[model samples]
Target: MRKTHLLGYAGFSGIFIFAISILLLHGRQPEISIRYDAMSYYVYGQLGWLLWAGLLGLGLGSLALAAGLWRIQKGAYARVGILCAGIWGTGLLIAAIFPTDPKGSWDQPPSTRGMIHFSAAIFAFIAITLAALFIAHAFIKDGHWKPVQKWIVPVTALTAISFILIMISIVSIFVSHGAPLYFGLTERLFFFMSLCWIGIASVGLLRSER
Candidate 1:
């Protein structure tokens, strides 16, 4: 397969993964002391495979458009989404490498797991917002945002709000000094927000392919 097509295929799968993530997070928060062992395993199940899949898409799309964006051309809008996707993928890899079992002692008070999760979220949010701003810039210049690309704006707005949300989540983590509830909500927010941007990108890419 051609590099673009391979990237697009992977991009398509990555978008699907993001969609699954949304489904994963679309519910009420589980109670405290309820270990996420099952969900954690599921998260690992998808995450372990999908991170690499996402990398292919992010790598190709970002490289293809980064130079153009530097010159203020189109598809610059995608650069941040690509960057955030790459960072989210990397963070998943890292978490998988050194995961904290939900019931583990470290998962309790002074949550090392929460810290790791929160920090990764901050990075991811920053990347998503940057990408969205640029994408919006491109979208505006061309006056070509379709119905699907329409999601990009709200997704970006959420991406920006997540910056604040993640910060509060982190602060709440610190204040509570490792409550599982705070940590859990943080994870849900971060994961779903990521899904939003990833889905937005997937929609754009698939539409482009069609």
Candidate 2:
């Protein structure tokens, strides 16, 4: 297979691994409530290494997709979009490196590691949202990418909405002093939508190469 195809497959496989990891982690630890608890909680439990591996997979996958897209797309928007995607991937790596504080630790002052993880997570979310928007705009401008625009545009819009919901959920949790506001659910929604967009883009890249 060509390098582009390899990258494209890598991107998709990375996401697939992450999705499977989430499922397995959730299944293995039934005590952790997926609705209220952050996915980071898994890091403190058994098989935490799997969580780390999953996150690394996601980060690497994102980077692979960004590199693949960069090779094919040539424009200011595409360049910026690829850059944002790279930032997102880097943020994921940082988060994986520095796991979030254990559950209930939030009531007390957060540790430096926890703060770094939180910041990286926030930065990654914002960066990926920007990536989706910018890349969608690039698709609109490029006839060759027009076919992708149809799928990406709506997915980007949903991704943005999901991101907004995540922010709102986070703010509400903070304001209410950790009252459960479905923060985990909102975050998962955002992740799913963003990953779906990435998957679509990666498939488009593969098709274009063909």
Candidate 3:
């Protein structure tokens, strides 16, 4: 198979593994509320290894997509997009290495490891959002990617909006003093949108001529 095709398959496989891991984790850890608790909290559960695997899948998938796009795209915008995507992948890996504090522990001061994990998560989200924007812009300029631009641009917009909602939910949580504000839901939406964008781009790469 071609290199791009391999990368494309890797991207799909990684996402598939992550999705499966999430489903399994949810089923195994019934105590964890999907709506109120952050996904990172899963790391403290009995099926914590599943969460680690899921994070690794996401991190590897992102890196694979970035590699494939970097090989296809050129110029300043493309370069910047690729860099941001790389950062997103790196941040995910960092987050995986450093697990967040226990659930409800946010009420107290964050631990050093927890702070690192939170920072990595934030950086990953922001980097991926920028990656989608810049990459979509680069797609608009490339004839080979023009067809994908139509699909990716809308997903990118939704990703950005979801990210904003996530920020608001986080702020509400903080201001309300650990009150539940659907932060998990908003965060899931952002992650889902971002992953959708990555899947679309990976499919585009798969269909592109070598």
Give the Cα error of residue 169 in candidate 2, in Å.
Answer: 1.4
Each model's lDDT comes to: 0.48, 0.86, 0.84
Q: Which ten residues in a row have the lowest lDDT in candidate 1?
A: 29-38
Tens digits of per-residue lDDT, candidate 2, 37-123, equal: 888889888898888998899999999989988988888987898999999999999999999998876567889999999999999
Better of 1 and 2 by lDDT: 2
lDDT of 1 by residue, 1-210 (tens): 434334435545654654554344323323322222223423344334433333334434433333323333335445554555455455554444444344444435536765575465456456655666556655544433465566767776776776666567556644565543345455556556655655545444434433
RMSD of each: 5.9, 1.7, 1.7
List the candidates' TM-scores in order. Answer: 0.60, 0.93, 0.93
Residue 146 displacement (Å), model 1: 1.9
Off by over 4 Å in 1: 18-81, 104-122, 140-145
Best by the lDDT measure: 2
Q: Model 3: clashing residue pairs?
A: none
Count clashing pairs, candidate 2: 0
By lDDT, rank the candidates, best first.
2, 3, 1
